[model samples]
Target: MMLAIDFVVVAVIFVAAVGAMSCKNLVSSVLLGGLASLVASYLFLRMGAPDVAMTEAAIGAALTTVIFLVATRRTQEVEE
Candidate 1:
């Protein structure tokens, strides 16, 4: 059961990561990246590394996503 859950979570994370990379929209890409990080944190917790999981969730998922989103927002889009 646990292994099956792990496989599902890994698949989700992989999809999110690929979506993040392939997305043309900046905001969507950032959100996808954050989703991947969040899933990774859950995987870490499931593997019995709670401290690493917390750090990954806080920094990799939350802080980094916010920072990237803010940075993307601050940039003006190029108009043709």
Candidate 2:
């Protein structure tokens, strides 16, 4: 059951990452990237790595989102 849960979590992380990378809009992409990081952190916790999960959640999700938002604010958003 734990393995199954891990698998599902990993799947969600993968989907979220793909969405982030492929998204055209800067805001949507950053949001999805942060979501992927958050999901990945949960997966790390399930795998018995709480410390790594915490770091991932902080750096990958929170810090990264802040940086991306700052960068986005400094430039014009490109349209596809």
Which candidate tops TM-score? 1
True-structure Cα RMSD, model 2: 2.8
Per residue, candidate 2 scores C-alpha lDDT tens digits across 1-80 of 98898888888988988998899987999999899899989988888999999999999999989998987887754521
**Across residues 1-80, which tens digit of lDDT does each residue of candidate 1 receive?**
99999999999999999999999998999999999999999999999999999999999998999999878766744331
Q: What is the C-alpha RMSD of each candidate to the true structure, in Å?
A: 1.8, 2.8
Error of 2 at 80 (Å): 17
lDDT of 1 at 8: 100
In model 2, the runs with Cα more than 4 Å from the true position are 77-80
lDDT of 2 at 54: 96
